[model samples]
Target: MAKPVLLNNITHQHLRVRTGPGAEFGDNQMAAPIIAAEFRQAQAHYPIVFRPTAGDGFEALALFGLAAGDNLFLSNDGWDADYVPLAVRRQPFLIGVSGQELTVHVDEDSARLRCGPDEGEAVFLEEGSPTPYLEQVNSMLFALHEGMLEMTGLIAALREHALLEAFVFEIELADGSERRLEGLYTINEEALAALDAAALDRLHRAGYLLPVYMVVASLSNFRALIERENRRYAVPR
Candidate 1:
């Protein structure tokens, strides 16, 4: 249950957020939602893939682990990856929409919130001004909001070209145990390649060509993910 409330500096001036990566803060996710804006950098780290959403839509995700409730990048020292997805970084905070206005909302039930003076970074100054941390959160929220809108356009373009296909991932562990992953979708490279000049121009003009290629390149990171899993199980290569 999310207890979201409008963020106000006056009422929440004393609030502190215990930042840093940890399982208690809900960082132990196998995959996290991503946006087109993240593809360029995320491709170099996590395997970016598409998952089917309700109806005919699709949502992009950055795979973090092979199994449920696992995040190989998370450790006591913090996230192992150089780039943590904005979706993961913007925890316990959400953007709210009212008419044409966008508002910041905080999840009051999140463990990240602290009232102690020495516990974490303050969300606001004693004089009721936004802290640098809070400003960063605001930037993240706005970026996410804009990214979501871009995703809709990107997905629509892909769907228009019939460029998404479902596939299964089957891998064998060092112990000879097999794991099969399903319900995932990826770009149909063949279809993309076969697109005529006009269709290709449309996607390119929409500024989606680069991210599409980034997603394709990101599939190679599956090898890195396998290596991480093997290491987790202490399986020698």
Candidate 2:
């Protein structure tokens, strides 16, 4: 449960957010929900996979690690990946809808909220206006909100075409131990290739073909993910 409160300049005038990547800020996540709008960028670093929702719908995700709570991309320096998914970037803040208007909400209990003065990026100016950091978070929240809307269409297209398939990943670690990942779903390339001409045209017209292909391209990152796991375990920590 998040302690969400509507962002107010007066009530939260002294807010300062810690923007750096660290496990303390809850960046130790194995996967995060991703929208189709960012597939091109996110696919470059993370494996784009689908997971089934409780309502039987599917949600796209950017996989960060092989095991639960394992984020191999995070290091003492910072996030290793060039492209951090928007979902991961937008932390401690969320967008809320009130009728037709959108509002910003912050998690009061988040570790990213700086406890010491002059410790992190300021959220507001001296006169109570939003700082550059807050402005950036606002933009990111809007993008995420819009991206979620776009994902509805993309998921619809995938469902209509029967393009998603469940899969299980069986990995042999460096220590000869086996790890089996289950309940993950991915694009079915065979079915995609076998689609009829009209189906392909429909997908293309809907602007979903590129993201579909992007999902396929992202699967290559799984090999790199395995390598990362191997390296993490090889180190004498």
Candidate 3:
């Protein structure tokens, strides 16, 4: 039996494990036991984070930033920190598994895995590889990718409803400065006039419109018109 490691409270919602070290496992195999073990005998300490879709029966671990001589555990059928790789120790994250088919989502450009019941479990690439930051980045990127299409659809719906035309936008900067952006297109002035101050504030808070100095003209040449207006009015410093 594999022993569980003594991990800091830092190990919380971010940890995951799959049946195998990699994703190529056949359906017939029983679910592999995933375990996070801390080595009391070893000087190295790498926490467990994600298990890539590869390497059957292998476990992976993570440490945010590790130095030499750090002891950690590598669990397959048992636990041992001696086998953990040294080169991967320096990286913010590491994947250590026997086989090469581990599917790891590293960055924004990586191909997203399809969503399904068989969406394989997450596991460690190696038993004692440090990868805290990398695991967080992967989790966030996957979430953003999954929701992007839905977000785009919502934006399109808002545009088609002409709800975007109700107001302008003004983006406040971190330096206490501001930039005014035009609304989606134009406002139905009559409808806007009917809105109370609170309603208008709600729209502005929701990013429907931005406030600016002045408007010169409504034309296909809006960019040129803005330049002309800025010269005359000297747009807010």
Each prediction's TM-score against the native? Answer: 0.95, 0.96, 0.23
CA RMSD, predictions in order: 1.6, 1.6, 22.7
- Taken over the whole model, the C-alpha lDDT of each candidate is 0.90, 0.90, 0.31
- Model 3, span 47-158: residue lDDT tens: 2222222432112223221122221122244223243322222112222233643333221111222224345333233454435544554454344333333434433433
Clashing pairs in 2: none
lDDT of 1 at 231: 77
User: How would the candidate models be sorted by lDDT, starting from the highest?
Assistant: 2, 1, 3
Off by over 4 Å in 2: 235-237
- Between prediction 1 and prediction 3, the one with superior TM-score is 1
Better of 2 and 3 by TM-score: 2
Separately for all candidates shown, the number of backbone clashes (residues 3 or more apart, or on different chains) is: 0, 0, 30
Where does candidate 1 have its weakest 10-residue lDDT segment?
A: 228-237
Lowest lDDT 10-residue stretch of candidate 2: 228-237
- lDDT for each residue of candidate 2 in 1-237, tens digit (9 for 90 to 100): 579899999988999888889998899999999888889999999899999887777889999999899898999999999989877788889999999999999999898886699798888999999998999999999999998888888988898888988999999999787778899999999999999999999999989999999999999999999999898669585
**Ten consecutive residues with minimal summed lDDT in candidate 3?**
211-220
Taking the tens digit of each residue's C-alpha lDDT, what string does model 1 give over 1-237?
779999998778788988888998889999999999999999998988899889878999999987789898999989998899888888788999999999999999998884478998888987898999999999999999999988999999988898888889999976677767789989999999999999888899999999899999999998998888877678366
- Ranked by TM-score, top first: 2, 1, 3
The number of the candidate with the highest lDDT is 2
